[model samples]
Target: MGIVINQSIKNTIITYIGFAIGALNTLFMYVQFLGDTYYGLVGYILSAANIMMPLMAFGVHNTLVKFYNEFETEKQKSQFLTFILFLPFILIIPFSLIGYFGYHQIASLLSKKNFIVYDYVWQIPVIALCMGYFEIFYAWVKVHLQSVFGNFIKEVFLRILITISLLAVYYNFITPIQFVFALMGIYLTMTIIMKLYALRVKMPSFQLVIPKNVKAIIWYCIFIILSGSVANLLLEIDKFMLNFYIKIENIAYYSVAIFIATVIAVPSRAMHQITYPITAKLMSENKHDDLNNLYKKTSITLQIIGGLIFIGIILNIHELYKIMPADYSEGIFVVFVIGLSKYFDLILGNNNAIIFNSKYFSAVLILGLLLIGVTISLNIVFIPKFGIKGAAFATLISITLYSLSKLLFVVFKMKLYPFTIATLKSFALLIVTFVLFYFWDFGFNPVLNIVLKSILITAFYLGLSYYLKLSSDINYIINSVFKKIRN
Candidate 1:
């Protein structure tokens, strides 16, 4: 728990900082500098690439985390590393060939509603390839219990580079066309840097040898491609499908709202880096008691932290939107629905890590595929009537139902649950906080109001949470912080 808290805190800070930069790019810079058309173009390209990333990596990233511990002998470990590294080529080579041969048709299909997308469509697969390898190496370090550096690079580095590019565009130093080209270059550069860092962490001695669990490894990678694809689709397909029904610029509006809501996910994403591998290990060892304890603590802790963030976003959303461009104002509903959905997933706390690491991953993958179908159908029906908000609703519905399904499956199969009295107490506190704070206005500038209100909310929420001892782990950390400050 100490290690988990320590790393999670550090990663949370890093992630939020990155998101701060992203907010600048998404809200002010992109909206001001690039305008709606270019901003939406970037969002569309990236979302498309993200959807392609899992298939391009052929699940090497996930497979590395799941099965790395299975190797006993050093030679076998090297072989395992070597095997996972090259496994993606089986799909990558063919996919590249197909994309090359079928580029026009692919671009035309995606650009049906917006012709601007077709111009930058080729960048998607290129960026996806780089992102795929980056994650592959990222999982390499995670299995070595070293994730801080990778987390920094993943969360902070690229955003900083994008910030630079965005500023260049602002100053007219580069056109949006050059910025798009530079963006792909940025991804390739980041991947190269990540590959170097991963090698420094654990250099692989290249060997053309079969790993111990070659069959299981192959099967897991295949399953992960399916599962990872479904997961990424659920997350990014909203933006992609928006291209089909609405004007491209509406995606820019949707992107802003989504970015604001996505801040709630920082804690979960931070915690998962360490918890994922640990959860994998615990499940493999059949340490059910420790696993259950982790599940509940993480759930309560994330619920506590994630709950605060959700309230903060939902409460301050109006002020946040006021600070955005007038055209983006319609995203208020988008923020609320997506914010709640992300918060719901937050409280589930490593349920995904458990499922993906366990033998029952295949079943979850099937569920994910069905939900993707549901997501697509809902988007098709809803977007025409509701516009970008419709996409948010689709996401909200699919994500909630999908998360609940996974939670039930974990509880029924493992007989482990992630709820406690603390969980319910935390939920009640969240509701009360929302009811009290949502309507209160500081009567200051939007910036000042957000800062002031956030402070008041944070101090009040943390004070009550500590006083009531909602989570002993969290309470201990808060006390420790106070002691350090006092000293």
Candidate 2:
């Protein structure tokens, strides 16, 4: 718990700083510098690449984390690492061949609604390869329980580079198209840095000896391709599909709203950096009691923090929108719907880690596939009728159903639940705080109003949470901070 909190706090602070930079880019820089069309174009290309990343990596990223501790001898571990390292080429080689032979056809298919996407289609696979390898090496460090550097690279490095690229665009140093090209270089640079850092942490001996469980390793990688595909698809598919239905510029609007709502996820994202490997370790060791305790602690802690973020976003969403371009203001409903969905996901804590490492992962894969089908169907039906907001509804419905299925599977199959009496208290507090704060605001600039409202909300929520002792872990941290202050 000490290490988890320590790293989680570091990861959280780092992640929030990254989001702040990203928010500046997404909310202001991209729109002002690139215009709506190129902004949407960049969004679509990246979303498409993200959807392709898991398949490109061949699931080696996940497999490494799940099975790293299985081998006893250093020789065996080296063989294991060497094996997963080359595993991605199984798919990468074939994917590259298909791209070479069928580039125009692929581009034509993707650009059915928006012809601008045709030229950029080649960038998707190139960027996906970068993203895939980045995650692969990131998992490499995580198995070593050294995630803070990887977290920084993953969260902060790329955004900072993008900021530089955007500045270049503003000063006439590069065209928007060049900026997009520069993005490809940026991703490649980041991946190379991560690979270097991972090697420094633990260089594989490059032993070619295959582990005895080669069959299981291949099977898990195959399963992860499917599972990771569904998961990434669930998040990014809406943006990709939007390219097929609405105008490309609408994606820029949608992306802004989604970015604002995504801040609610920062805490979960930060905690998962460390908790995932820890959860995998616990499940591998068969420490059911510790795993359950960690699950509940993470759930309430994230709920407490994530709930505050959610309230703050919804309460200040109007003011936040006012600061954005008026054309993007229509996404207010999108923010609310997506914000609620992310908050729900945050409270699930390490549920994803539990499932992915458990025996029932295959079952959840089937459920996920079905839910993605439902998501696509809902998107098809809704987007034509309701526009961008329709995509939000589709996502909300699909994610809610998917999340509930995962929760129930864990409860019935593993006899573990993430909620407790503390969960209910946290929920009640979230509701009360939102009601009290939602209807009022300081009559200041949008930025100032957000700051003032956030302070009040943080003070009120954390003060009451401390009084109620909702989480001893959180209370202890509060006390520790106060003690340091007095000293």
Candidate 3:
């Protein structure tokens, strides 16, 4: 818990600061500087790259973390690291060859719905390759329990750079075409920096000697690739489908809505960086009790935080949209559906780490792939009927259903549930706070109104959470901050 809380706190601050930069970029910079069409293009490009990322990395990122500590000998661990590093090339080579031959074919098909996408289609695989190595290096550090720098690079570095780039874009320093290519440069640069940091954390021995457990590791990587791809697809494919179903600019509308909602995931992302390796280590030692305790604490703590974020987003969603362009205001439903789905994902805590690191991980491949199928099908059926909102609905349904399945699987087989009495109470508090403040408009300028409402919401919500002691962890942290203030 000490390591989890310590790192998660730093990670949360970093992630939110990144989000602030990103919000500036997303809400103001992108909309004003890049405009809707190019913004949607950026959204589509990154979403497509994210979908391709798990494939290009071939799950080495996850495999490294989950299995790194299982080996007893330092020599053996080095060999294992060396093995996974090269294993991705097995998939990367063939995928690259295929893309080389079929690049135009892909561009043609993608262009069928939106020809604007055709010329930029090649950047997807390029960024995906960059992303693959980035995660691989990131996992390298996480297994060493040094996630702060990686999280900073992951969350903060790129957004700050993008902020600068958007400034450049605004001043006509680069064309949109160059801006798109420059994003690939940004991802590649981040990956290179992370690779250096990962090396400093643990200089790889780089032995050609494969670990004795090569078969098991390879087998795990296979399932991981599928499961990881499933997860990425769930998060990313909505934007891609929008490229198919509606005008590309609609993807920008969807992006803004998704960005507001995705903020709820900050705590979960922060927590998972430390939890993944920890969960893996705990499972290896067969520490079921500690694992379950961590599971519940994670659930309650995240629910408290996520509930706050959910309340903030949903309640202020209307006001938030008021500051955006008029066309963007139509995505209020998109924000609700996707934001609630992400909050549901937040309450999941470390369920993914538990399942992915468990022996039943292979079984999860079936479940994840099943959900992917359902996601695509839902998108196919619904997008034409509902436009970008339809895409959001598809994602909401897919993620909610996928989360339920994972929760049930973990509870039934592992007898671990993340919910408790406090969980239900926190949820109830969230609802009451939302209902109370949502209709209580400030009736002033949107900016001032948002400020007053947010401050009031924060005070009211945190006061109640503190009064109920929904999470001793959060309460202790709050008290510590107050003590520091007094000092």
Candidate 4:
């Protein structure tokens, strides 16, 4: 648990740093330099690539992580790595070709405005392939218990590159189209770097051994593909649907709010990165008690951290939006809606990982697919009437239901419920923080008020946490930092 907390702290810092850069770029630079249309295009391209990523990688990223521990020998591990690396190429080439030949048709289907959509079509496959391979290589490293570096690369490196690209556009060094191309190139470069780094640690030899359990590996990979695609769809289908049903420019507005809201999930991502392989190992050894404790601690800790972020965003969203362009202010409701959904996710903690690694993973995927259908249906019905806000509502409902379904499955089937007294206490703290911060008025200057109120609100939250002893992990971290400073 200490190690998980330590890694999560490191990853959380890196993620926030990257997020700060992203906030600058998305709120100020991109919105100011690139018009809404171009900004939306960037959002669409990335979302589309993410939606396509699972298929592009053919689920090898997750499969590698799950199967890595099963192999006993270094040679066997190397062969497994080699298999995952080469396996994606089989899908990549054909997928790229399909994307190439079907590019215009896909573009036409996506948008009615047809404003330079084809210009960036070529980048989609490239971005998808890069994202796919990056996940694969990152997983390869994660299996070796080397996650912080990958976290840095994922949470910091890519955003830093995007920040640079946005700066180039702001300086008029590159046109919006060129910036899109540059973004594609940056993803490819990052993938190559991840691959090289993984190789440096353990050169993935191309030797294929006739494993007795190769059939099981293949089956696992197939399951991963289905499960991964359904999961990605749950996360990303809304943006893709927006591109279809609404104006492409609206994506930028929605994306800005979604980014702010998604920050609440950062701690969960960090914890999951370190805890997932651990969960797999525990499950494999039938260590149910250890797994249950991990699940409980992860849930409570993430809820604590994610609750703080959600409160920060919700309480200060008005001031935060003051920095953005005027048109984006309408996204305030989206932020709240999506923030709640992400909060639900955080409350569930490592439930998804537990389900994915469990024997009932296929049922989980089937349920996920059902939720995807509900999400799309809700979007279809609500988006026409409510626009971006409607999309946010649909997301909130879908994800809340998704979280509940996973929790129920884990409890009913696996008898794992990650709830404790701390969970209730954290929820109480969240409500109190929101109430205290919500009605307080600090003055006319949104920025100044936000800054002052945020400081006050954060201090109050921490003070309350100390009074209640809400989080030993957080207390330990603070005490450790103080001890180091005193020394």
Candidate 5:
């Protein structure tokens, strides 16, 4: 818990800073500087790349985390690390060849509905390659329990660069087209930096020495690819599908809503950076009791924090939208729908870490494959009728169902549930605060209204959470802060 709390706090702060920069880009600079069409194009390109990222990396990122601790000796560990580093090239080479040979056909298919997407279609694979390797390197560091630097690079560095590039656009230093290319360059640069940092943490042996469990490792990586693809598809497929179903600019609209809803998941994302590797280590050591304790603690802590974010977003969303371009306001419903789904996900805490690191990971692969099918089918059916709102509905429904399935699997297979009496209490507190705050708003400027409401909501939520002792870890941290203040 010490290591988890220490790094998670740092990761959470870094992630928030990243999201703040992203908010500026998504809500203001993107709309104001790039305009909606190019914004949508950029959004589509990135989303499509994310969907392809798992396949491109061939699941090496997750494989590294799950298997890194199995070896006891430095020689074995270095062999494993060396293997993980190069394993992706097996898929990368063939994928690159396919992309090279099928460029026009691939471009044509993606841009059929919106032709602007065709020219930038090449960037999808390029960015996906960068993203795939970035995660692999990120996992390289995470397994060593050194996640802060990697988390900062993952969360903050790229967004800051994007801020600079957006400013570059604003100052007429770069065209919108150049901005698109600059994004690809940014991802590449991030990956290179991550690789260097990963090596500093533990350099992989250049000589290829296969571990005894190479067969099992390869099998795990294969299953991980399916699971990773399913997860990424669930998150990014909506934007990809929307490109075909709606006008390109509408992707920008949906992206704004998605971004707003996504802020709720930042705590989960930040905490997972540390919890994931720790969960893997616990499983490797067969420490079921510690693992379960961690499960409950992380679940409650993320729920409390994520609930506050959910409430703030839903409550202040309209006021926030008031300051944005009128066209972007239609995504308010998208915000609520996706925000609720993400909140549900957050409460599950380290459920993903538990399942992915467990032996029954193969079982989840079947469920994940089914989930991807359901997600895509729903998108095809819904996006045409309701547009971006339909995309939101599809995502909300898909994530809710998928989350329930994973929860049930864990409960049945591992006898571990993330919920407790505190969970219910925390959930009730969230509802009460939302209901109480929902109808009220200051007549001040939208930004001022948002800031005021957020402060009040934070005070109300955290005060109640502390009083109820919903999470001992959270309460302890609050008391520590109070003690420091008194001293």
Candidate 6:
């Protein structure tokens, strides 16, 4: 528990640093420097890269994490790592060539506007290749239980690069097209840096001897590819579908709101990086009781933290919109729907980690595929009607169903539920804190109002947590935090 708390605190700091950079880019630079259409194009390009990343990597990233423990020897681990590294190239190279040759036809089918998507089309493969290896190497580092550095590279370094790129765009040093290319360059460079860091830890050595479980590893990668695709689809499919149904400009607006809403999930994301490997290690040792306890604590802690972020955003959403251009302001509702989806995800705790690392992972993937089908169906039906808002609605519904399905599976199949009396108490505290902060009129100065209201809301939430005894974890965190401050 202390280790989790310590890592969580470190991750929180890194997340906030990333968030600050992200806030600057999204709220200030993006709005002021890029117009809606250009911004949306950037959004689409990134979303497309993310959508293709899993398939391009052939699930090697996840394969690394899942099978790292299976290799008992240094030579065995090296052989497996070597195979995973080269496997993605086999798929990505041909796909890139195909995309290059079929650029126009693909663009025609994807968009009505005769935009220069072709120039950027090849970047999809490049971004995918870079992002693919980044995840693989990141997982390699995680196997060593050194997640904070990887998280820093991912959450902090990437955003910092994007911020600099946005600044260049703001200064008119790069056109929109060039900016897109610059974004691709940033991803590629970041991947290189990540690789270097991983090498510093332990350079991956290629061994000629093949492991006996090669067939099993291949099957695991195949299953993981499908599972990873479904997961990415839940998050990125809406952006892709939005491109088909609406203009590129609308995507920019939707992306901003989604960004804000998704920030609530940062704690979950940060903790997951550290927790997944830990969970995997525990499961490998058949430590179900410890796993279950960790699951509950993570769920309650993340929900409490995520819920506060959700409420803070919801309460001050209007003020936030005022900072952005008028067109982007329409995405306020998208923020709410997506924020709720993230909150629900937090409440599910480490249900995903548990399922993904467990013996019944295939069953989990099958359920995920069903949910992806439902998500796609909902988006197709609703996107044309509601535009970006409808897309948000579809995402919210899909993620809600996805989280609930996982929770139920964990409870019924594994007989592991992540809820406790503390969960209920945390919910009550969240409600009371939100209601109190909701009624306060913070006046017209957006910056001051945001800061002042945030402080009060945080105080109320923590005060309520202390008073209600939400969890010993929370009480311990409070004491530790104060102790550190005092020291």
Estimate candidate 5's alpha-carbon lDDT, on a 0 to 1 scale: 0.91
Using TM-score as the measure, name the better of candidate 1 and candidate 6: 1
Per residue, candidate 3 scores C-alpha lDDT tens digits across 134-213 of 99999989999999999999899999999989999989999777788888899999999999999999997888787777
Q: What is the TM-score of each candidate against the true structure?
A: 0.99, 0.99, 0.98, 0.97, 0.99, 0.97
By lDDT, the best candidate is 2
Select the stronger candidate by lDDT from 1 and 6.
Answer: 1
Off by over 4 Å in 2: none
How does residue 180 of candidate 6 score in lDDT? 82
Better of 3 and 6 by lDDT: 3
Model 5 off-target regions past 4 Å?
none
Q: For candidate 3, what is the total of clashing residue pairs?
A: 0
What lDDT does each candidate get?
Answer: 0.90, 0.93, 0.90, 0.85, 0.91, 0.84
lDDT of 6 at 69: 93
Candidate 1 has which clashing residue pairs, if any?
none
Ranking by lDDT: 2, 5, 1, 3, 4, 6
Model 6 residue 12 distance off true place after TM-score fit, in angstroms: 1.9
Model 4: CA > 4 A from native:
none
User: Model 1, poorest ten-residue lDDT window?
Assistant: 204-213
Kindly report which residue pairs in candidate 4 clash with one another.
Answer: none
- Which tens-of-lDDT digit does each residue in 1-487 have in candidate 6? 6666778788888988998888888888887887777788888888988888888889888778878898888878888888878877767778878887988888777666526455566677788878888998888888887778878888899999888888888788888678888888898888898888888887767765556887877787888788888888999999988887778888889989999998999989888877888888888899889988888888888888888898889988888887777888889999999999989988887788888888788987888899999999999999999899999999999999888888888999987879999888888777877777788966759877888888888888877877777767778888888899999
lDDT for 185 in candidate 2 is 98
